[model samples]
Every structure is written in structure tokens, then in C-alpha cells.
Target: MDDDDDYWNTSETKAKAFNFDDDVLSTQEILAIGQKSYSPSGPSEESLFNNISITTVQSAAIPLSSLVSSKVLDLILLAQSGKDPSKETKYEPEQTVAMTLKRLTLGRSCSLHVHRSMKSKTELLDGALAIGDGNAVLTVVLFLIQTLNKKLVYELLSSRPVALNHYIAFLQNEGKISELADLLTMLGRSPEAAMYQYQHTVKTQGNNVDVLLRKLTNLLANHFNQPGVDQHQAKMISDYIKLLEWQKHVNKPDLKYNSVIQWLAYNCTHHWHEGAGNAMSPLTLCQRHQITPLQYDWVVLNVHAKSGKWDIVESLFTKKDWFGRTTISSNIPIETLLSRLSQLQASKQLLATCVNKVANSDDRLRLAHMYKIHAVVIETLAKQKDRSALTNYKMTLNPQSEEYILAENTLRDNSIKWKN
Candidate 1:
């Protein structure tokens, strides 16, 4: 019985020596031990955790309460905060490294996830703005364009100037010229959009003059001529359009001045000024391009004459004074007018009218005789009172003609002096 008790005591001693729970530890003691073993090493680990939490908070990268999609938010938060919402557990070392890399390259690592969600565009924009990321704001704008159409996107952006500006910058940087122009148009900034297209064309197609002119002309005809634009801007656009159109017409391989004249007349008479507010008239265009008055008159004369608008052609050379006395404008010489008119197959009555305006009788008689303006020839001979010259003029006329008879009657009246 002594040996049995000694063996049992030895076994109990051995068990006590090996047993981990020999001392009935309290909960606190157990917890303290566990913490000492599993706790992070220092404040650095705590600081990292706190920084991630702050980044997630400040970035507004997640909507914890909102019913909107959290995928984009979760990815952004995961990229920035190094925490995955899908997995609440601890990260493996490889995953931690990967997430760190993703954080380092934010936009490149994850493109925007623009999945359809319950959020309205305004709500999405607000959320993006809350993050204060320009790229994020632009991404939301693009998503808005895709989902709600550009029309609604414009309305939404109209209220959000900052976001609109950010998206503009993004489009410019990305070379999205057409989309940018469309946005500008939808915002009631069509003139600015037209100018943007003009600039773009000038930059890209400038080396090819024909192509450049074609594109610029089309833009002006279509967009720059909009009446809803500001008056001053419209005038500027009008002038530019005219310039481009003129260039296009003038640069043609087979250019005709008559065609140009007709084009100018048609535009000025109808399209240029009637309802086109601030558009330059043909005369205004001529002046702007430094065409001289005489050159313009010549062009006008020939153009009207060819069109059988003889009265308009005649009216162009005359001006009415304040007293309502109609006289030749005298901007062009009478002789030059007569010569051109004659070439245009002017009426004999027109020729006589021109001959009658000559102040020099000798020159008048000579021109009158040359043009066969018989009435002017006889009148000029009677005014000169040179019977010998009148007789010589009579030799050129048929004796039976009235002009010849008038010359003979003038000679017989001897009040006409013989400049013998």
C-alpha cells in the first residue's frame, strides 16, 4: 500500500508538471496571453490601419448606407485602402503585395466599373464629386453620357460646372474632339463648338488647302451662320464664312469672274442680309477685301449687263444728290463706261445718253461719229458752230437721213461759225 501511494503521487506530480491549465486561469489572464502573442508589433502597424481607414473615409470611396452599386466604390476603396469588402478575413502576403501595387497605380490598375445601378446620374456625379477626384468625376460624366444620352448629360452638367469643366479637360486630353464639340453644342455654345472645329481643321488639314477650305466652308454654312448666336459673334462668323467661301470659289481650277459676280449678287440680294443678322453684304465684302470702287463697278456693270438687267446696270453709274438731281457718279470715266457698254451690245439710246455726257465737244463729236450716234453727232456739230466740220460730217451721213438734213439746216443757218 505504501509503494502504491508513492507511485500515484509521482504520476500526479508528472501530470502537474506537463499540464498547461494546472492553475485555473481567469478570462482576463487568458485574454492577456492571447493578445501578447497575436498583437501587432508597434504603432506603425496601427498607423497603417488608421491611414487606410482615413483614406477610405476621405475618398468617400464606398457608400455604406446608399443603395447604389458598391462595386466601383469597393474597388476604389480596395485599391486605396488595401481592404477588400468581399473578404473580411486577413490577407495573404501575396494579396497584400498586389493590393499595395494597385494602390500605387490607382487609375491604371482598375479602369472605372460603370455597371448599371439604381443611382441616378446626379447621384453618381455627387458621389464622384464627394471623392474629389477629377478622373472620377470625368468617369461619371462619361457614364452619364452612355446611359442617359448626351442630351440629359448636358442638362446634368449644366448644373454642375465644376464636373463639366473636369470632363472637358478629360475630353481635350484624350483627343475626343467630336464628342467635345457635341457637348458644346448641347450646352447652347454652338458657336464655340464651331470655332473649335475650325481650329481643329486648321491644325490638321492646313497643309492641304483645298481640303481645309472645304471643311471650313461647310462649318460656316452649317454652324457658324446660326441666328441664335450673339450678334457680334455672328458677324465675325459671317465674315469668316464669306472669306472661306470666297477662297473656295477663287481657288477653283476654272474660275470665272462672271460666276463670282453672280454668286456675290445672289448672296447679297437674298441670303447675306435679309434674315441673316449681321451678315456682310456684297458691297461690304468687297470693301473688306480691299477691292477698289472702280473694279467693283466694272464687275457689277458686266454682271448686270449679262443678266439683261440693263436698267440696274444704268442705275449703278448714277447717284442722286440731296436735291434729288440724278447725275453720273463719275467714279468711272464716261468713255470707259461707253466702251464697255458698247462691247456688251448696249442699246443705241444708251450709247447716245453716254455720248451726251461728254464735256469736250471735239472729243464728243469724234466719239459720237465713231459710235454712229447720229443725233448726238448733229447736236454736237450744231453746238460747235463749225459749218466746215459739219459739212465734212454730213459727207459721212446719207443725204436722205434726218441727221444729214439737220446738219445741212444747221450749216445754212450761218449763225454756226465756220472754224476755217
Candidate 2:
């Protein structure tokens, strides 16, 4: 029995020794344990706990909170009892404020305590603004607006224009356009405020076209015309007005086609009279509006022809100047006009007149083939006397073999070049 008891005691001692060795942490285990103790709850909550854990670890390479919590508590207690922490230590005011702000960023719980611990309103404002987190600064601003004087809150926000702009953007994103406009107006940005107001009005009263137009006109005359207004902004407003006018006219059945035509005519005439040059012309507008050149020419021709304005139609085919520059009325190619005129045999005289102006041999040949004008066709073929033209003319002759060979020989003889 005595031997058994001694053996049992030895085994128990060995077991305790083994457990103690297991509990002794290695260097890596020590680091992991330290991190676990100070680490935040989860990744989603990282922002709230970043300054406390990861940032602290990166700066100090260790968890200072584990080593210094008790001492910090004692210092706080002493400081509350009329002892200054800075006076008894090397802590500077800037360092203290920075540390406090970092702690406050941990969460609402830390924020409440740190906010109360701040020495003054100025320190709180400076700390919050200095952090530069949009949501955090917004919370601080709301707190100030609620608990502090309005004038003081305004002063604080005004001092940080970048933060103010961010807050304004946040409000706008939240669909609080009215509040954004009011805030902009308070900041003496009347033009921006008016723009926001106009946007809001447009979104709400979009169906009320006349009212919206009047409101826009008023805004342009009152706010946009100011001396300090941006030139580009003014131009944008003008373009919007033009777009609105176009949309308004296009929506009406009676006004749709005529309005566009009239607008094109007015712009072309205006550009010509003002010598704005060729930057904007009827052809350009037609192209921009996706109107085909044929369709455009047809409109001009039909309108003038119906109005008994043959002079305009004639000018459309007439050569205007030595430079070959012509008015919009005279812009159609002669070949195209002749092809169109050939479709109406009553317009044969007009077709002949246009063909007389043709300067290119291939173009005259093509027109003659297209219109079956025998005189022009024979004349053009005789002038060229090439194999292709001779073959073409031979095909046109009666199926008399003798006549065909005679015509071919005549063409070949004409094509022969004699030595001078």
C-alpha cells in the first residue's frame, strides 16, 4: 500500500508538469493571443475597430491597450481629481486630441465618452472635421446642429468647405434636393441653388411644359445672367431651351414637319445674313436630322414647284458662280436632278437644260443611257469611238449585219490617231 501511494503521487506531479509546459506560449502564440484580445469582432465592423487594433498594432507592433489600460485608468482618475495628465507627463494637447479622436472612431459607445471628454466645442469640431470621414463628420454635424447653436454650427461647417461640399453631395444623393438648395443658398451660391431648384421642379412638374418653360426662362434671366456666371453654363442653358423648343414642336402633328422646315430655313438664312460662315447650313442641319439628301431636295423642289416658283427650281439646276459655290436651293447634283426630272416627261425640257451643264463625258453618257436620249447618246459615243462605245453603238443598230460592220469600221477609223 505505501509503494502504491508514492507511485500515485509521482504520476500526479508529472501530469501537472506536462500541463504547465503546454501553457507556456511560444513567440508566435504570444503575438496571436495579443491580436485576438485586441482584435475587432468581424471584418464588416473593421472600420469601427480599425484605429483600436490594426492601426495600433502597425504603429506600436504590439497591443499597448493590454499593457497600459490600468495605468490609463489611473491617470484618468487622477486627472479628474484636479491633476492634469499633460502636467504630470509628456502628453501634448495635440497628441491627446488625436488619441481621443482615434478612440472615438471605434464606435458610438466610444464616441459618446470621448465627445464628453473633449475640452471644448472647438476641439470636437476640429477632431471630427480632421477625421474627414463623410459619414462620421455628418454625424458630428448633426449632433452639433441638434445640441449647439445654429450660428455656431453654420460657422463650423463654413470653416470646412470641403466637408460642406461632401455633406451637400450626400444630401443630394439622398434626394434631399430642397435642403441642398437651401444650404447652397445660405453659402451664397445662388446659381447652384437655383440649378438644384430647377432640377427638382423639372422632376416633379415635368408634364407641365409651359410652366416649366416659364420657370426656366425666369431662372435664366435672373440667376444665370449674373456677372460671375460661367459662360459654359449659360451656353448649356441656351442649348436646353433649344432642345425644349424642338421637343415641343415635334410632339404636335400639325407643327412637326413645317416647324422643322421653318427652323432649318431660319437658321440657314440667319447664318447667311450674319456671315457666321458655313459652320451651320441647311445641308448640315438636314444631315444632323437624318434627312436624306434626296428627300431634302424633293421637299425643296415640290414646295417651289407647287408655289409656281420656277425661278427657284431653275436656280436649283443653274450654276451660280465661278467658285462653284451655290445656295442651298442650288445644291443638288445636276445628274440627280436630271434623273428625277426624266421621270416626268413633261419636265423633259428641264432635263435637257440640266444635261447641257454637264462637264464630264462619263456623266453625260450615263445620263443619256438613263434617259434614252438618242441624240446625246449617239453624239457621246461618236466622240469617244472606243471599243466599248463602238460595241455599245453597234448593239443599238438594226440587226442588219452589213450596217453593224459599217458602224464598227467607222468607229475604228475615227479612233485612229494620224501623225502630224
Candidate 3:
């Protein structure tokens, strides 16, 4: 026995000689090991029930409940306007569905009476919004502000922004930024919903990107004389004579001539302002829209084309709107501009025009413009020119350019990768 004890002690000493820190176990693992010491088979049911308590669930956990009553389940299905008897939910299934299943199980009260006499919260909210019932609207909005889901509390907001805004303002009034992210994320994913929400948010918050761009332009202009050379140059180039021309054309009384005239004047940033002379001013609308620069450029171009800036279509291709279809530009007018641009090669204003108007829709005319652009680019490059109009135009107009073709190929490959 003495020899056995010495042998065990020697083995224990050798084990202790190793770095325990290197083989340290987590508290959970240590607790598991400790638990094995008593019963060894592992934790008994008694200990598990004694030591653990559930606090919360991100999702719900409904339990099997005969008390929920089949009749009540039928009523819920009917309430949802579901006619299919096969789709009927069972008492146990509600156990996992989020909500007060426990309360539902207490079928002691006449739930049908309660369910029928009182409209589910959603109907009440929708009805109130329909009648412009402020009290109901306020209550629903406050609840929405507090929680993303109004499944039980109120009806989900309808797809209309005006209608939705009617609710959003109510939420904002109740200070509901806390629970807005999930809802906003949903809205952002939905094109129409996002636009609606955007307009609503702008109306209520008044801190939208449209206001920011105006501030940026004004700030850049005011601080043009500052010490930083780059900042000053940005303002100078930005405020160049063409900026005014573009703005004048953009703001002209003839709404038909302007490139982008939204119902809201405050929203259209000077994205394609090719003002007097060849000097032009370009501003990005993507920063405000929360889209990629390339994606943003695509949206801006479409908006421009839709609006009327038939001349300012090239902004889609200037190393920004990457992968955008050059053929799409042919849909806009490139022929008329091509002749004017042919003579006007050596101006920054014209250069901006070239960049902004690179999207030519007419294939034959666009091809002609491409040829003219190519000619102008060769001349400018030979003379060591610094961004002539034709040079800028050539940079974007020629879809056949090696760089343009490469970018198009890469973009196409990426699209395939993502879709697959």
C-alpha cells in the first residue's frame, strides 16, 4: 500500500509538471467534469431541473396544450380568413409560434366572445387609419415604434408610403427609432417600399441626403479659397461656369427640358448639370440613396434619361458606373451631341458633358459618335492634352475599348457567380 501511494503521488507530480494553462478547460466543460464525479453517467434529470431556468427565447416555444381548445384554434384560422380546413393549426403548434401561448391555453374564459367582440389589434389600427382616427393611429404607431412586429398588436402597414408615412410619422412622434431597423431593412430590400419610406423619413427627419448635397455644394463653394489645394480645386471645378449652365437648364421653367425633375424639387441633386460653355459640374446622387457608386450611377442615369437630360447620359460609364451597358446609352440621343462635340474638344465643361452623356441610345449615331470620339482622343493624346471634351467622351463612349470590354466581362462573370 505504501508503494502504491508513492507511485500515484509520482504520477500526479509528473502531470502537474505540465503547463495546465495550455490545456485549460472552459467553465462549462469543468462543470461537466465535476458533474461526472458524483453519478459519472452524467447529469441526472433531478439536477438538470434543479439548476437550470429558461429566461427568454428569440423565437417562441409553444407547448402541447389541450386547453387551447380545438374550437379556439379553428376560430384563429377563420380569423386569418383562411378557408382551408387542412391548414388548421393545432394547440401544440402554437407552442412554438411567438406570442402568449400560455394565455391562449387558459381556455377557461370565452375566447371566441373576446376574439369576436373585440377586433384583433391589426383591424382596429387599419380601420382607425382609414377613418383618420388619431387615438387609434397614435396607439398603433406607438406600439410599432416600440416593436417591429405588429402581428398581434396591429395590422402590418400597407404598401403605400402615404399610408405608411401616416403611420411612420406616428411612430416617429412616439420616438420609435429603436425598433425601426428591421422594418427599414425590409423596406430597403423592397424597391417601392424603400422609396416610400425614404420620402416619409425625409419629411419627418428633414435630414435627408438631398439637403446634405446642397450643403456640400454650398460648403465647397464657400470654402473654395481655403488652404487645401485639392478642396479649393474641387470647389473651383465644381463651381466652374458650366455648373451654372447646367443649373440654369436644370431649373428652367420648361420642365420638359430639365434632365431630372422630381415631384419634390428638394430631392434632385445636381447630378448632371452641364452648364454654359464646355465646363460641366457632376455630383453623385448615390451617397444619399445608400447604393454602391456604380449602382447609384446606373439609377442616376436611368432617372436622367427618364427625366429628359438626353444630352447628359455619359455619366454612367466614367469608371464609376462599371458594368453598365454601353449599348443602353444608344437608347438616348448621341447623334445630335456628336456633331456639336466634334468641334468642341478642348474644354473641361465639354469634358464633363462627355462623361455625363456617354450613354448613347441610338446605335448608328452612337457608333458615329464613337468614331468622332476616337478621332478626338488620338489628336488630344498626341498633343498631350489634359482632359479635353472629346478625350473625356472617348473615355466612356467607346464600348469597344479594351478596358470597357474587360470590365463588362468581369461584371458578367460576377453576375453568373452570384446567381449560380
Best by lDDT: 1
Model 3: per-residue lDDT, tens digit, 99-213? 3222333322212222221234444445556655454455545544454445433235545344566655654566554344345435542333233333344345343334534
Task: Estimate every model's Cα lDDT from 0 to 1.
Answer: 0.66, 0.60, 0.41
By lDDT, the candidates rank as 1, 2, 3
lDDT of 1 by residue, 378-398 (tens): 887677666776778889888
Which of the predicted structures, 1 or 2, would earn the higher TM-score when compared with the native?
1
Residue pairs with clashing backbones, model 1: none
Worst 10 residues of 1 by lDDT: 95-104
The weakest ten consecutive residues by lDDT in model 3 span 108-117
What tens-digit string does per-residue lDDT give for candidate 2 at 41-75? 62444554566766454432445565556654455
TM-score (C-alpha, index-matched) for candidate 1: 0.37
lDDT value for model 2? 0.60
Q: How does each model score on TM-score?
A: 0.37, 0.36, 0.21
> Judged by lDDT against the true structure, how good is candidate 1?
0.66
